[model samples]
Target chain A: MSETEALESMVGGEYKYGFTTDVEYEDFPTGINEDIIREISRRKDEPEWVLEFRLEAFEKWKQMEEPDWPNVEYEKPDFENIQYYSSPKKKDGKKAESLDDVDPQILETYEKLGIPLQEQKQLQGIAVDAVFDSESIFTTFKEKLAEAGVIFCSISEAIQDHPEIVKEYLGSVVPKGDNFYAALNSAVFSDGSFVYVPEDTVCPMELSTYFRINNMQSGQFERTLIICEDNSHVSYLEGCTAPQYQDNQLHAAVVELVALEDAEIKYSTIQNWYSGDEKGQGGIFNFVTKRGHCRGDNSKISWTQVETGSAITWKYPSVIMQGDNSVGEFYSVAVTNQRQQADTGTKMIHVGKNTKSTIISKGISAGESNNSYRGLVKISPRADGAQNYSVCDSMLIGQTCGAHTFPYIESANPTAKVEHEASTSRVGEEQIFYLQQRGMDEDDAISLIVNGFAKEVLQELPMEFAVEADKLLGIKLEGSVG
Target chain B: MLEIKDLHVCVEEDPSEEILKGVNLTINKGEIHAIMGPNGSGKSTLSKVVAGHEAYEVTQGDILYNGESILELEADERAHLGIFLAFQYPVEVPGVTNKNLLRQAYNTIAEEQGREELDPLQFEDHAREQLELVDMKEEFLERSVNAGFSGGEKKRNEIFQMAVLQPKLAFLDETDSGLDIDALKIVANGINELSGEDNATVLVTHYQRILDYVQPDHVHVMIDGKIAKSGDKDLAIKLEEKGYDWLSKDASVL
Candidate 1:
């Protein structure tokens, strides 16, 4: 998108990327229960053990309560009112004739959303990951991945086709009874991508749950699993910059990653869910739990997210360094505008000797929104020579918005080292004037300043994601300030 | 190229306290003018007002660039018409490379003038060429805009930007205030090199040190928010010897 388009969107306080893809869909009835979970598992034709896993998770969820500690105010989402599963109609004679019969409208929408033509063709699953890697160069890409023993497919497909790998790593990083939302996801989650990079191999294609769900009507409980074996590498992306209509007001997704010795997994997310109207009447409530485990020495896992939407967001994509010399990183840029509330950060748990972690977060709040960076860095007593560094910076646009930073750090090991730095800056009139005097208009000046403020976190994004994220920030904050 | 007709200005925060009280000045192309004044005498205020700083309100009169009144333009609009003000204190823009802003300003002005914009590689070469004009190192272009820069380095950066933008009417506000002798020479050389027949340079200063390096065609001393006296380059030399006390009395009488 052009800078002027970004400026115009910010001035109007409107979501810039919203389009619909017309397709036949079959959805489960609204509400949550053991029967609904059984029906969802039965519909997917999951294996008996997979159904048992869901049944156990459902019992665990029955004993749990919704979390209330997040620094956000919103009406509790009625679990009974949300449909447990929905997808494009999948049955005999309901499927399209040929694999090349991909919808053109989806490609048009992707182009309008700034996806390159090549990417549109290459990464065209266009569903909540239904029949992902289905056609086109997808065959070649899959062949390339198969040549390296990389298993990439929908989680349901993975559970049926690659049961051994799924059984070994599923819920290993984030357990079924870990939290309120995660337990709910484990019980009745719909479709999400599953990736497995074999030992001593590098995945040839970037994996993503692009448009994770096609008709995300009632709610989305997507559970994603990724496992990187020894000496393996994989880069996974989630979500997209396109603004989703999101008729469903709730989204609870779970993502878990496991990295073995010398393995590295880089995961990035660009969340641009609907953030309601100017008055904050309706929007998506995004509650997700994402965590990664460095299971062996010299392994690494990094989480980079650009969160610019959702009326109320509560997520902490974190990492647990369990192996000596393992590394973890969290780079995030969370922006909230127009009465939106975002309470998001990361947690780094250094458990083994010589583990290291780094956290850099930038928060921008505008239009009376509330944005907070709440993070924790815990170096256990046995983590000798463990190190952690964190920097959380906040920027306020208008007078009514708020930006907060809450960093909880603990270094129980005497030899561990930890450093934290925080700063809060407002986009003052003087700084605007300085840029304007150099020939940039007001919107351009604000865009430049915001980009400068978020540069460190943005540089951590992948190439295409970085470009889109920069444009997204420009669209969100350019004209929000005077 | 610039004409200030009985200009009166006040801070928008305090509109009752006029800072520039009926100031009059006319600058022509190829001429270098020096405005020397004491503390709170409105020399800096005049530069800021001409650059259309929103914090300052022009209470009366008008400013004309190339004989067209520009009182209605915003700072960036006036800037597109080739008016530049090098601030006494350049604001720090952390994480934004100096080259980024310079190329943006350069391309914008080029497009405004109906000239083709340079691509990134071409612009990088063009930007590096201007660094030599300010006697600045190549690394300066890679650093954040004036963030953590020394005072002298910041002043040189202002001139470096002036060279890149190539404004028609440039206001150097205290551009030489905090420089040592060696740094002052470098800044003076930069100012002298950029000054040409097509553009006018207005140097706002407190002392005669910079004027000795880059001679001015006219010198004016401001007192109590008005230009109290106007003369040739010798006027700056005279003020350096006698200070503004002698001129403050004459300005009050006028």
Candidate 2:
């Protein structure tokens, strides 16, 4: 169209955060050390014990080098130079009454992204936690959810109001030293969603978080914790998008979930961060660590994600089945267009008897993008008669794109049954011709095919988020198909 | 409305082995033509070439639709010009429902002709009406495109699409290959109903049984990629009675 306007002037065309916001921030100067970790904990007004946890995590992070195992390549981030604590000027203290009370400019960013922020904007039964920049702006349907005795609010507020519950479950699933990015997240995580469903309570609404990175220079480090008590059930959805910029921004996040006896949790994510231009400059370096611990018998946890953005993505939402009769599942559709690269999959570690897990991954590679699925299913001797099934399929759009799958399965229990299936296919020219011959244009044909390929994973999303995810996938494959 | 001149095409993967060797044919409006030949005699190749299939290299052919050279047009462009082909083996696309697909196809062609797209409700009504013409069940529209469909059901769905598309020049590529007697009659009847005063059809079949129901306007015996004999409808009866071996032996004289 017209000459590429400043990221601030853009309205929409797939990348909703193609606009920048005029905002100032109070942030930590680049570099990571014990002092920086303490400063972050102090800035959040956390207890001394929490500060110790951050310092210990910083030490562990220093002992470990940056992971080079992923199929992505990027210059090592100078941790000391990066601002770890960045928040809006003085409005950080102002609590939003509802989505309307949130900054008009911030609301405009979400509107440009087409995310529904009002009560009527929500479909059927999805309750939203809208996180703007480094803080949770407003959470809807909280009063109705209080009737069910479920505590769903911002992590920062949870720490302030429900410190005991937060202290009991925080890091219980994902330890501070889980990974390099996780440790980094523990040291400087700003704010994310906190969810808790009490025993025997079925949450009344689908809990959701819509993360908007408004500031161009801000690095979003959000830490989320979810806990489901015995016989409790909840479904949580997360959607994230960032403003477009010329310099690559970093987003390191950690999400942990704990499901006790007979509890179930379903976590869904539609990640559509601005993936930069075709030449691959100025995108987000998304390194996230998400894990769930099934600590109760017959408990279950499922993670489903549709990733169509980020220039370099290093993520593996995994599950640790530590209780007998627990179940874990991971369904994902990761699409890499242009010069993007993603190395994602899942890990299912069976530590208890009769546990089971399933992983289904579909990767679509277009343009010069590289997509990979790396997974592991480990069954310990104590996990008697454990079972695991993993299916990973990759669809390549063009010859220049690449798709790869790596499965590492280790079983100490002779009775365990673990099977894996993987296939690499190029969406056949015949398939497109068949659709076009039926009168569909080439773009429509490709979108139909890709949607069909990703239907299994898309079905796992909440109804409201699923529609947005489907449209986002369609838009992401625009120029890459032809 | 359809014309093929000195059509010489070869498999793109193997250029030395020619598929269609200088075949020539012209089909006018309102005519139902039957193309019968033995397997590997380029019966399918000729149909694919006319529909602008990309696999076969049309090295020396010129396909014209209404006096315009269509050899350079894309498959979709050819479709916009009222060319439709019922694939011998329908593709199974999971998560894409038949109703959604038909509506998209119908509206795309309509838009290409400078017509407004049918609204969602209108499309459903039109698709439901078209499905009934092929004796298809209403449930077929809700199913994934050919996913888990039976042989007969898939064949009927193809005809259902034909009825909905209403192309001026339709190519039924062995549409009765795996159809049972009942399905064969239903498909044939669907085709016959869709063939009208301004449109035509090219029935590509190996068996003469389908001819018993649809009754072609002209029957052409294909031998070695060329139409060996072109005659009236009775020629199909002759071929059915005497078998293609007789034509193969006599056509060698040419």
Candidate 3:
């Protein structure tokens, strides 16, 4: 066979998580409006104030236009043809009380994804909140978290059980009108994980949320919020996967984090949504808005993500250093392959004196895909003695793929220092041959090279997530060499 | 142990431009042979072709290993079949530690031969023994494969890998090109330690200086694409004294 043919065969491994679950579920009718928002709020049993917040966000969303500045091309999604909300029906109006109470098919799906939902079958020292479609199917280790004064539950559950805390910090960091997607997520978002660590407390376990979009026609709009109180610490992980479908699915998520004085929040995500087939016929269009606010002195917020899926991804998880001596960090590795396009990086806005921020991003493009790292660093005049460092690197696997870097730095204070570095490289054929001659096959060689290129960012991920991200990257670049 | 029959090869991009024209050679167990030639005499091409490099097309040739044709095999397949090529310029693979690369290569060959694979601890112990053969520090195993290594260090690493792999038919392609006297001695010592009567070694070099440490049983002078003269090690000293111009003229007259 020709070299190109061999590469194609290597990368054409079928998506293992493409099977759909046969579950009795309900979904809203196609399209978005105030009535749909009200129906969603009513179904969730949200309080009046929460409904008012959604309505206010909806009004603002109607006036906002979708941003077109991203370095990606696709037929714009017809929002009117999408179902805004979907949920699996509860058994006899009761939530699953135990593993036996859950639907066998739904449990089987998670098991197939290698995520064991049953407490006895789970990995120790970690709590899992499994969000399927528009609702949290189950949350494990809740009682243990509650003992430590940590609130780990679904957003809808938080709103119902701890309305005062929820109302105080819901949109404080990322306001409703933050962006077009943020506003839309604010209006129609269903279920996502919520965590609250109390003052002077360190969460005993790693909190994670596994999100699966199972409904074929529904768009997943999840709202996640994490709050670390003064002198508190928490590490949160998120993993998402979707079944394969011909029609594009929309996933517009809003994740907001708040770190108070002396608090630290580590947020990591491994996003493995369906990236369509080799021809790019169907996949998810992931438009997400994530931000963190260092609201008190000496607080730190770090965002680490390994993105390997989605046909067109447009997201920049940012940090706002609003307190003196605060620190913010962003580490990302984005892999785009087989007609995928990703325009992603991070934003660091320094607002207080002596603030610091660091950004490291790695983008890998293969098989006609385009990957871009677009980042911004802004230091305000009041941010005296602020320092910022940013490095963006791109790796191209094949001749047809393209990689780009766009960095914007703005400093109003002479005392503030900012440094930016960018580099672009291709997977050289000689490198592959060298490894091949060492007895490793072509695919193994590519995986090693690509992983090494992204090691700086991959190492930032949690232990288990690092392994998963490595495998996902390997799968995404399969058959990418020519 | 290895034989090349009427080998005619060319650049894969333009197969008409033959690099190796009807070249024939044979080496048996317990023999060490040196193919010394001038620049662009197809010495490197012959070594690469024997290792199954894909950039060259063997239009009319057959490479036999243990009496079976190996022309159709991939480079890694040839590697698994006990064919080792110590590259002239070793590629630097950053982020892959020398230890990991050696372990993978060792285990791959072992698995192919149906030998039990060594665990990490066992392999580490085994690799350290080979590291001593090249006089490399223990820390060299922790560094990336050849990345940031000096030219001499890279040559030492090539020999280190050869010691660990223990190939039956080893090809040292210009392994002495960029080495100081100290490094050259170390590399030659490692090669000497690895070579035995049970295996054969082929040294492709442009100079005969390396033969002082690891003597060869036979020396062949290559001009254009074929061997022009075959003799004992005295041929290397003669070529070194008279230069390759006389050999080229003699081959042309013949």
Candidate 4:
């Protein structure tokens, strides 16, 4: 068999996101350099400070090599072979693009996911940039955000319009030198969502309404920053329930959040990238760095993520509590099917008096996949009366799959209270039978049990996102079990 | 409505050891049949086999529901064909709420029947009414399925589920066990209320206590792997007075 046929046949009804999009891509020269970074910043009309930040991160990234500490095995990504930038566009095909040649696989998935026809064309990157506004719903949503004093746009646009806020809070939570992937993302990161909720105001709606309109093909290395000022509340959503088909074999992204005095920020992500075939050939290597900071007294920051894609995923969405009486929470549900491998969890750092943190991590593995929860909870000496509670649970679907949990706890203050609980459960045949006897087919039975197992984390998502996340789980597990 | 002829069952097709040895039973519509037996006499096994449990394999037998052989059907397929089994010990599924399970099951059957499915709001009202039939509160629907439920409550939940599905034929395995007199009456009342001219019920139990509440049209005592004697409700009373020892000699005959 030809190599292309083998690759095409690898994706079927099981894994959703393996289609090759036919859009035109304007690529930079294959490889990374100082000139490439400068050209990237210049093309976006970035300011001088942003250019300097990219250069500094590029220099530091040159001094670092890829780390191999995560409990996952894959062919390491070749940095030299990777093209640094790909901004997809077709100048002349603006009109009638929605009616023609969107990949039928992509359309079928969107149809099954219940996405509207207009939005399906918009999400598939079929040149819906301007003509998709025939209904003006997305335009009205943008106006609503503007009227509510919420700044919502791409990160590059934010760099141009709101540079002061971007410069002040960018990388303040996760600096450029934090890790290898973050450094790379800082150097050549493309566009991602940027949200800012003003003080004394609540964002009118979840940020998905804004993201769904401008959701273009983010090829690789995306960056996001969200800031909630004093007494403000915002729930920001990243990624989508739709399957993301990318030609790039490697993905690196960075996300940072900041919450100030009496503010609350809830961040949710549903990542459904491609995870290759049963034998684990040609899939994405997802390495991302996400962190949030409760930087003021009485502030709260919560991270809820549903990760069900990628050939190999390594990330720890962490929270640092720096203000007295602050709160941090992390709720995650990570699923690995076939030969996928995911090593993910969170870190909760208590550095202030009367600070508290909660972490809930649930991992599910099916086929021959492997999933692990690695987390940490730390309390410093100044954090008197600080409290932390963490629970990590893993559920295995098939006999060949594996689940592991590694929890670390450190405390320097005697007055602080820390608790950790971990459990590994298998999806027993008996459990599946119980649900099946109630009229659900085998696939729906497994899906129901999995959703039930991850209910604690799934309910943490915003109202609309919670429903989509549940459906995404069901879609991922279709035909996975006999 | 249901018929089992010369049935033989074992744990995963192991020939040397069989659980059900040449058992035969039949039931028409609208009748309540009681299966009384001692411990390990294959009462529960018979119910599970009829329910198409994966733990048991039917090496030689034919189970017919509505004049069609159902041995080749999956458990879920049998369930859609109006077969229901209330387990002796309902497994505690931690994250699934009772309401969610019932709604999903009800809608699945309804969808197969080409009936309009109920939304969550409609299902809530429909399920809460079943809760009243089992003497359970609305809060009971919010808890996880059988998780952290007391023994009596689990049995009652099973009956509550039967009320929701309203199956054409049901096997209540040990439903009378682990229930107080008041709770037993509630369960008995629920069973009697759901049984109509279109459906049938088979009560698999050890004691005759539940028979006092919902009188059965016939009583059959299972011993070893097959039924040894058959009679009316008075036979259950006689077995309660004289222990199962009087039926042991008759059970060994092939």
For each candidate, give the TM-score of chain B.
Answer: 0.98, 0.97, 0.99, 0.97
True contacts kept of 1: 0.79
lDDT of 1 by residue, B1-254 (tens): 78999999988999899999999999999999999999899999999999999999988999999899999999999999999999999999998999998898889878888888999999999889998888888999999999999999999999999999989999999999999999999999999999999999999998899998999999999998888999999899899899889998886676
lDDT of candidates 1 onward, in order: 0.82, 0.84, 0.88, 0.79
Off by over 4 Å in 1: A1-14, A91-120, A123-140, A212-217, A241-248
Instruction: Give the TM-score of chain B in candidate 1.
Output: 0.98
* lDDT (tens digit, per residue) of candidate 3 on A1-482: 22122122212245767879989887568898989999999988889999999999999999999889999999988989988888888777556877787888889887767667777677577788988998898899999999999999999999988999899999888799888989999999899989999999999998988889999999899999999999999999887889899999999999999999999999998787888988998999999999999999999999998888788889999999999999999999999988999999999999989999999999988888999999999999899999998889888888898998989998999999999888888888878887877788888788888877887888887665565466556766767786
Clashes in predicted model 4: 0
All-Cα superposition RMSD per candidate: 3.6, 4.5, 3.9, 6.0
Candidate that scores best on lDDT? 3
Give per-candidate clash totals: 2, 6, 2, 0
- For model 4, what is the error of residue B38's alpha carbon versus the real structure, in angstroms, after optimal superposition? 2.9
- What does candidate 4's lDDT look like per residue over A299-325, in tens digits? 999999888878888999999999899
Using Cα atoms with residue i matched to residue i, what is each candidate's TM-score against the true structure?
0.93, 0.88, 0.96, 0.88
Candidate 4 Cα errors over 4 Å, as ranges: A1-17, A89-144, A209-219, A240-248, B13-16, B114-122
Reference contacts preserved by each model: 0.79, 0.75, 0.70, 0.70
- Interface root-mean-square deviation, each candidate: 0.6, 1.0, 1.1, 0.8
Q: What is the TM-score of chain A alone in each candidate?
A: 0.90, 0.93, 0.96, 0.86
CAPRI grade of model 4:
medium
For model 3, the local distance difference test gives 0.88
Let me know the DockQ for model 2: 0.67
**What tens-digit string does per-residue lDDT give for candidate 2 at A1-482?**
11112111222246756677676566556666777767777767887767777788878878878878787777887665676767665454566766555667666565555554566654346677878777777787888899999999999888888989888887887788888888888877888999999999999888888887776656788989999999999999887778778878889999999999999999988787888888988888899999999999999999999888788888889999999999999999999989999999999999999999999999999999999999999999899989999999999997899999989999999999999998787877788888988987677788888888888888887664565456556667876755
RMSD of 4: 6.0
Best by TM-score: 3
Q: Tens digit of lDDT per residue, candidate 3, span B1-254? A: 89899999999999789888889899999899999999999999999999888899999979899999999898889988888999999998877788988898889889998889999999999999898999999999999989899999999999999988888889999999979899989988988888899999999998889999999999988889998899999999998899999988899899
